[model samples]
Target: MSTLSLPPRLLMGPGPINCYPRVLSAMATQLVGQYDPVMTGYMNEVMALYRRVFNTSNQHTVLIDGTSRAGIEAVLVSALEPGDCVLVPVFGRFGHLLAEICERAGAKVHTIEVPWGEVFDPQQIEEAVQRVRPKLLAIVQGDTSTTMLQPLAQLGEICRRYDVIFYSDATASIGGNAFDTDTWQLDAVSIGLQKCLGGPSGSAPITLSPRYVELVRKRHHVEAGIKDSHHHGASGSRIQSNYFDIPMILDYWGEERLNHHTEAASMLFCARECAITLLDEGKDAVIARHKLAGDAMLAGIQALGLQPFGNLQHKMNNVVGVTIPHDVDGEAIRHTLLHRFNIEIGTSFGPLKGKIWRIGTMGYNARQDAVLHTLQSLETVLRQQRGPITGTPGAGVDAALAVYDENRQ
Candidate 1:
């Protein structure tokens, strides 16, 4: 077979965005033995870095070897015993995913859902938690499916009051949004490098509070070959998946340095570099940058006479959802944008499918030029599709520029 090659294109879509250059370079560095002192040192550093990225002081912060979904499964399977009750609040696709994963883990899952493109009020979630009396409350902080970010601040308080363990999949919103794991009282949180962190999507960085760690340790089972006489099977049922057992994974990452699967060295490096870049830039500053880009993108779409989907105030800082015009073939416009302008935007799924296009300003792409270029290309594609354009030819660009100028002041 011929050598592999890739095209040059801008990814302005929901996730798997361009990686930061430094992260790519770091991933290219030489590999090391998984148990090598140098490797372990880097591992510890990664754990420390992700703690800051997650805005938590949890000692169990570490990387799961697969994608973001792996981290979610690891947390759920390790913490949940068969027949354990889990309360899920579903607003979008990812929230549904959490419930599905919990169900697979043998948890008796109960869900409360809002319409797509809408977020739950804290009261609604509290009321549901009260009714369910669940052992854990699982939710997604942001679901790119409908481009809505559920407010998590008050949910944590409600969970605490109701004596429920709180967990969130922050894969789509972590770095580019306001997420305080400690202050929010989130017991467990998982995130990916591909979103606001500006890295490729293989490694999942996860953190667990002391309470979560204690619970998972109860299910710990060492491999047979490595087990000493003192090691015992879980007091409860063993975790459903060997690969996703958090306590065993932590043993590898923890001071005991017990072996788990061989770590994905390159992805770990990339994840570490991603955290360093975000922390160096200052988390608040990076979030502000995303907000500015999101605002500009929204303003530009509005200027082009397209209505936005969802509650705008509850929209994520990293993505904007715009309605597809009635006369336009949404896929055709997206195709033209990718082929002609080499820019990629996203399409929606489920109820919103074929109805809205999702435009992202996230991670390394959260910049003025990226926002303006996307808006300009979208404007051109819409015009080509014979979609009605209410404003002047360059109105989208003008509107985006106005937002940029305002942000500068």
Candidate 2:
């Protein structure tokens, strides 16, 4: 265990995608006291940094101390009450996850499920809302399991007309695609650093709109002195978990500056750096890079006679689902790539497991070399395993090269 050293893998997988070298460096900086002026200064900057990153003027911008799931839980428990109904438009695995969480929170969960690789239209969601009159409309913008990106813009406007709160988990596609929290009327959105943001897991950036804030603020009465006085008020009902209380989180981020847990300093550092890097490159430019990488990766795979998995038009630009060849052991090929080629890709989950491979070109790894190398390595390994092949592996590289050149020119 002491000698364990992992290779610098080309991470072409679902997520915790390759973090930027700059982010890694920032995480390694010397630690400061949790409440030290310098550390809190950085924390304040983290809020500002992610505000720009999220493209919102939301005053409730802050990071959760846990993974993306923690952020999701925080929003659900904070915004929901017992007996409230929530409409979830399920197109992939993550939507089911949101439904499950809401169910645990005692929400009357209503689901509108589609095929694995499909997404809902605004009309379908409106129909569901018509049926349920849900208090909240929760869905995923991008579901990595199926490589499908459910459109959010139209759903936002529709939900507002229905008096429903809108929440989204953008963990899989936030930085890689076009997202506007304010203009889209999202009540709340949660995202992780592990994907298109180009940083590690263990933290999630969340944004909340003022209307949503006021709605949840109804639940915010926690005073030790008068704890038992208002049994009828919203706060009288204990939140499922104390660790994820958003009113408390808000107090910590707001001028109250109340002490909760000592913040995750290093994670905050890395998140700040990731957002800064995004801003430095410009969000539009970073998205354009992911677009190019996705296109090149798709072109290369198609050149190798493989078909992409999903509705090509609706797929997230950061991840692609590829059909696994008939005679090839998908696991063995992935293992060989990890051991020999020093690259890593992924397979799918649940019903789609082993049927498709998910290759990612997200965050810092969305580049010419990463895309081309993954295609070339996959081709070589498939050939050695006596898997069916097309003309030449070099052709895939050349196709990607042409794309890269075209982009530059």
Candidate 3:
């Protein structure tokens, strides 16, 4: 096989944003044994760093050795038993994903859905929880499919009142938006390094409150080969998937240093550096940067006379969904932007496919230059395609600059 080679293209999409150079550099470092002192130290540091990133004091913060979905599945499979009732509030694609995973875990999944662009009201969720009296509430904090961020603060309280375990998949919104795992009373939260963390996808950093830990521990089971006389079998049925067993994963991460699977060391390094970079910049400041970039993108797109998808008030700070103008072929425009301009934006999924464009301002790409360049290149591509262009040339750039200037004060 030939050595790897790739084209240079700007990723301005909903996820897997360009990694921070520092994170890439970190990942390129030499490897160490999983139980090596230095490796374990780095592991401990990662747990601590992510606690700050999630704004939680939970002692159970650790990286699941897979993608964000792995973390989601681990939590659901460990916490739920067959026929257990799980309530999912579906606002967009990820919401549907949670319900599907829960069902696969043998949960009796009950879902309440809002339109793609809208978020659920706390009262609405409370009403559903009271009616269902579910064992758990699983939801997505942000769904890039519609560029919407569901409000989770009040839902936590509702879950607590109803004695429901609250879990959120914050893979898309964690670093760029407000998420207080402790303050919001979220029992378990899972996140990915790819989105606002400015790292490549692989590691899933998750935090579980003490209550969640206790619940998961009840279902813990040692692997047959690793079992000892002291090791008791799981109180509940063995979690369906051995690889996704959270208790075993936690033992691997904890001081016990028990082996579950070999740690993905490079990805751990990448995830660690991503958290370090965010904390060094200050979480509040990083979130503000994303907000500014998102605002600028929104203003620029509006100046170009394109209406944005979804309710503006509930949109995520990391991405914007813009309506594809009439008479314009969305895929052709996206292809032109990628090949001709060396820039990439995303297309919508499911019901929104071909109807809108998803442009992201996230991680390292959440900068003035990236946002302006995307807008400028898009305008040029639209003009070339003879697509709708209601505003005068350069209006988008001017509007974006105005937002930057205003935010500078």
Candidate 4:
């Protein structure tokens, strides 16, 4: 195999936002066996850290050892019994993803779609629920596909009135937005550290209310052949994968001390550090940081004469979608930004492919320096990709700095 050498790039993309140095250092710490007391101690600490990060007292909070999608899939399969009805309100690609996962899990999925970059009002969802009356409602909180944030503050009350389980994929918003799991009455939530948590992608932090845990418990199962004090008894419905069973995972982390599978210890360290970083920053400050960065980015792009793609009021406070200029090669600009400027921004997916570029100011990168670097690199690349024109780089930076100055007073 060829040896790999990766150059440092300013990640101003939709995710994996330039990891914190402390998180990287934490991940580099010496590893221990999964069952080692020190390792399990760290694991328990990770759970506690995520609970604070999620602003929830739910006892079922834990980590899934995979990307954000893995947590999404696990929740779908574990919650939706076959033939159950699930309502998904789609405004972007990730919303469609929730429907797909629930469908594959055998739930009768019903989707209410709006144009990309738009969010469904709670009334629309309530109207749909009045018609289909789904048993569960699954949605993506902030879809990077359109850089739009779907509001859920009123959604949980609606679901509760109808006795529906409410679930959200908050991978794109967590740590960068104000989210309260208990106040929102979310039955379950799944998030990744990559987007706004300033860490590498691998572990997914998830929290579930007691109601969700109880539902998942119905479908729990035990692995067939393990011989240790860690092995546990089987439940009725036989969860499909031995690896994805949440109850067994809880048992391992709980007093039962059952060994479900080898936890990703290095990832657990990084996950813990990510949560601790958020807590240290103060969640409101973190959200405000993202808001300022996003505002600066949007202003910068607009000053360059590009139109942003999403509803101005509901955009995610970290990522923005800029419409690609007619004569410019969007991918070419992205390539130049990466190779020449050592900057990384992203292209969109599906309906937005080749039409819009997704720029992010997430996590550690959500600051003036990173935002200005992205703007400068973007300006240089856009000029190279499609002839230069006069634009006000200063205008955007000054506008953002003005906010900081005002806040200081």
Q: What C-alpha RMSD separates each model from the true structure?
A: 1.5, 1.9, 1.4, 2.8
- In terms of lDDT, the poorest run of 10 residues in model 1 is 225-234
How does each model score on lDDT? 0.91, 0.88, 0.91, 0.85
TM-score of 4: 0.94
Residues 1-409 of candidate 3: C-alpha lDDT, one tens digit per residue:
9998877889998988899999999989999888899999999999999999999999999988899999998899989999999999998888889999999989999999888899999999999998999999999999999999999989888888889999999999999999999989999999898999999889999899999988877774656655542323456666678888888788889889888899999999999999999999999999999999999999999998899999999999999999998789999999999999999999988999999999999999999999999999999999888888778898898999999999879
**Model 2, range 201-317, lDDT digits (tens) per residue?**
989899999988877767735555455232225443555566887877887877767887789888998989989999999999999999999999988988888889989999999
lDDT of 2 at 87: 93
Candidate 3 global TM-score = 0.97
Q: Which stretches of candidate 1 lie over 4 Å from their true place?
A: 220-222, 225-234
lDDT of 3: 0.91
User: How are the candidates ranked when ordered by TM-score, highest leading?
Assistant: 3, 1, 2, 4
Q: How accurate is candidate 1 locally (lDDT)?
A: 0.91
Q: Once model 1 is optimally superposed onto the true structure by TM-score, how far is the C-alpha of residue 54 displaced, in angstroms?
A: 0.8
Among all windows of 10 consecutive residues in model 4, the one with the lowest summed lDDT is 227-236
After superposition, the stretches of candidate 2 with alpha carbons farther than 4 Å from their true spots are: 1-4, 220-236
Query: How many residue pairs clash per model?
Result: 0, 0, 0, 0
